[model samples]
Target: MSYSYTIQQHVYSFPDLKSVLAKASPFRTGDALSGLAAESNMERVAAQFVLSEIALKDFLNEAFIPYEEDEVTRLIMDTHDNVAFQEISGFTVGGLRNWLLSHEVDSQKLAKIAKALTPEMVAAVSKLMRNQDLISVAQKCEVITQFRNTIGKKGHLSVRLQPNHPTDDLRGVAASIVDGLLYGSGDAVIGINPVTDSVDIVGDQLKMMDEIRQRFDIPTQICVLCHLTTSLELLDKSPVDLVFQSIGGTEKTNASFGINLSMLQEAYEGTLQLNRGTLGNNLMYFETGQGSSLSANAHWGVDQQTCETRAYAVARHFNPLLVNSVVGFIGPEYLYDGKQITRAGLEDHFCGKLMGLPMGMDVCYTNHAEADQDDMDNLLTLLGVAGCNFIMGVPGSDDVMLNYQSTSFHDALYVRKVLNKKPAPEFETWLHNMGILDDTGNRLTIEPSHRLLKNL
Candidate 1:
């Protein structure tokens, strides 16, 4: 009455084994078996018998463990080169389920290898592993890192132009401003805020690069930063001089964490295709908002670690893939209130653990967010040594830019003579007297030039 054998608590019969084999069959390959030769009943049975015998021998050899005195060894030796049965030898009915679920086996190959595995193995493999999309994630990481590096190193100055300006005129002004600054000593590439003026950010950047190639001959590349919309659009139109997207607002929403990241990935993918040469050679800046909190030092502050974590995760996730540059713009933890913020407080926010490596994502001091002089000083002092490559701000006077540079360089002569004085001497005077300084100067005042710097 009991026509089955029980092994390891499961009943097995000829019919049961056939049903299990049918289930373990390879995933449907659409049309691989359409043209088998038409034959009579006895001929078909004979062909099937030959195939089954060959497969059975292989299955016994691969699926069964070898012993000093074993029939399976003899079977494998007999069916040595049979492709269909080869895989059968590798799996056993009892262990089939476990092997199927293991990393060693792929779901797609199940049916092909079933001859070697028992019904139990096929059932187990089918139930265990799910499809993973790691390849896409890894591609995204590589793209992000490439963009970041391009924008990070070549960028020296940060600019914010009114969105309405004509592209040609804007480029000239940008060129002039940058040329003027270069006349002195610093290699400043303008950083622009694109969110405030989308068109100006995108249009002028393309125009400026075109003009630079046409009008002037600067040996090195000039860089600028733009908002997301402009960046995405410009990435399509021309080579991005440099582009950065602010990650989040003061609040934590799905838009900041999820949507923007998707947008970044999309643009990055497109940029890779559109870019002719190496895209990673340019820098991709990550200009983050002020950390969400009352304290300037908290990584996420009010926004909490969720915001910083997301940001750091993006950088950490991408850094391994990008070949060129990655820079992080970190804002201070507190709102600017004149001289209330301290250097130590600045350090906590500026030097605190945020994400990625310091060299990978350089910090940008943004307490200057309100353009407070003291806050600017605090940011420079605390974050400068911590490997901050850029200072985002508007220059009130040439003196301010000069002061920032002097502080950055820790120029002993300029510090002792100029910043350490009762009334700050004219920047030109300090330059003239200090043999290391250059005499060339620009007539940048607080009205227009300062306005350009303010929005940045």
Candidate 2:
């Protein structure tokens, strides 16, 4: 399927799509209502346009256009006690889209409906939305902000120290943590991904991280991103601050990872049984991405992006501390290149935030993919603007075991500096007290003391 149009001597083809959005003007482009009907692929474009129009905030006096209400609208109205219709009487698809964009609608209310609304409806209204506008709605959306109280301390951004060693070598893991802490990273959680799935090995790694945290008197959490079953076995034997798992769009894909909602609840209950983290702090850390559904042959005709968003529904049910979309790690068959990866990253962050999860981006790429640091830099900036909760911090942006390049510890610092953000309050105070960061939470110029440099 394709839709083509010419504008200013440029011919643009909307591939895998079937409709073209017409520019808004005083004169009608066409009289047929069918002309405005959107195809699945046109949803993004239409949504973008509606968001852009709403950002203008000039639609108050204009009569909202009319369209038939479908199951999505009916469900939304019923769930919310018809407040949806009360807010926008005589609502049309176009009108509802505009109402969502307009300032008149409560962002929390909009988010509620947005989450309940079908993906097709969301795509239809949000097709033409600008990134900034998307960010605006996300800021007030309920789901995007729900986990805020439970994740980071003092409302500061957080970072995870994901030190992965090919052999699960405890010493190498210690070196990486030393590097991350010296650079003032891992304020979110000092987590490691063990190469071996053995419960004993992962249990040992968790003990190592706990030992380091206690040794340095650092105020931070610890986690080992082992399979859930391994994590479950180690619960009583180790100090697992947060249980880590990777979720996908389908039950089968999640099962392949040895997880499902029931297992997740079991982990949740088990974490509470151990009572490792601070009071009120959430104990689950989840990672997701597009294409996992298609990768597992369970997409069921839905686009990868949409399927990925639905996974957020599953995630929020558990009230996780961190839910990250490792946007570019899956490779090009799902997201073809840097541009595609960048767009999906932004979309995933936006959707996750809208759904009320503390979102982070593992801004990264594989060696064979059509992406680079420049692309990651671009995504890093966008996700920051979108109010991302935290991000991954490797020593030099390269994970030797995972064999991929992601944002480095320094990259997190740069974004914090550029955006005037700080790490979680408790960690920030620790850094300042230790002279690793200044009062403003900026990295200090103090030389690496022998205390930090000696072992390495």
Candidate 3:
């Protein structure tokens, strides 16, 4: 089917309501009513008008006419409830599109509901708009934002790489390594991590990554850098999956704190540009550190509450640009000084213990879970209930080495067992016979399998 217009670029360059109606169809008030009577039954046409939207919002910009939004909503509901339309056409996609083209839309409600758009939503919507493809430029952003909210469900398995690898090829190498190792076999989004604090380094990495993916035919993308959130320079360089930034450390006096704040500002500014810019999808991945000495007087380390406040502050400031984000919980043991803290403690703080404080942004648990298996289980279960969607850690040994070849399917199966409650039947039988499967045989009280721990 031929379309009247192709949104090859953005959606801003379209006609207005007065111009479109005048140019496309000469339907004045009396004339429109008369025409409706001539073409179809008045009742049917009126009912259809409530269900149909005008063709491509080209008419709105044409004559400087102000369309009242409430009218559009009332029309949508009316059409949806119309017995004739419902009985004749059921709420089909074509029916919805036709309704939207001829009717008005509540822009305010659309904005409120259009919060977290992601990449997957793109394909889904592209299918919806395949023929008409009439999504307004402004509406495209909102749709993408809602899409992000859906696909933003990530797991806590981050891929670590050497940021200061001293070569322009680092990004490509890192991308290939990550794609082969973590992303290749696992079902998680991979964050491209960097050690050095340079945008140029990140840019090179991204470039190399693109080249590697193109050359090797890998269908994967490394969400931008997981480093100190600084500068739009990195975002400006490439379309990213996410923008993971670090909140300054514990001590306010440390030099890293000063640098981190600077990075935070840059990241915030870049995120603003991204949200408003009709480019590809983007996100703000945030975290706070109590690594060594406290770098800031903020808290011992940036707790979830602090993370939520900061995230809200950024989201509020950026408005639409701050696509879905996560408040990373990087406790001391995972960073530099302290030994391993129990995963239960981290979950109580990060994943939340049924309080439901941080409701929106995804919560990413760091590789710190590798410190203990019971804690890993606790963190995983808590994350499941709390609705967190991202996870990070290295494969093979949890170090920054790309070792896909070395990944054990056995270990992968064990993780499946824990995550899906599909414990091996034989093992459960043994545990149950030994009185470990609970009285109902539905709950298995297996000691956190120490076998996996031994391998680690």
Output the number of the lDDT-best candidate: 2
lDDT tens digits, residue span 124-146, model 3: 12223322233231222122221
Candidate 2 at residue 399, lDDT?
97
- TM-scores of the models, in the order given: 0.41, 0.78, 0.40
lDDT of each: 0.32, 0.66, 0.32
> What's each prediction's clash count?
41, 18, 59
Q: Which ten residues in a row have the lowest lDDT in candidate 2?
A: 25-34
- Give per-residue CA lDDT, model 2, range 1-456, as digits (tens): 334454456454544221222222111112012133233334434433433333111222221111132222232223332343344445544565556567866655764554344333333334445566566665555432222123432235678888888888998988898878877788767888777789889888888888778877787778888888888888777877788899875566676676777888899898877766554557788999877866776544445665576577667667788889998888766666788787777777777766567778799888877889999998888777667788999989999999999999999888888888788766777787777888766767767564666654
Identify the runs in model 1 with alpha carbons over 4 angstroms from their true place.
1-172, 183-189, 194-201, 213-225, 249-258, 274-282, 292-306, 320-354, 357-375, 397-456
lDDT of 1 by residue, 1-456 (tens): 112334456444322222222222222111012111212333333322222323233333333223243322233234333475465455433343344335655423533442333222222232121222111111111111232222222112211211122243464445444433332322223343333446555575666554543353322223445555666766656656444554432223324333354566665565556543233433344533323311222222112222222233333222322111111122322323323223222222221121222222222233233334344454344332332333322323222221221122222122223322111123234334423233332222333443223332
Show model 2 residue runs off by greater than 4 Å: 1-97, 104-128, 140-155, 446-450, 453-456
- Candidate 1: RMSD over Cα atoms? 23.0
- Best-fitting candidate, measured by TM-score? 2
Residue 271 C-alpha lDDT in model 3: 61
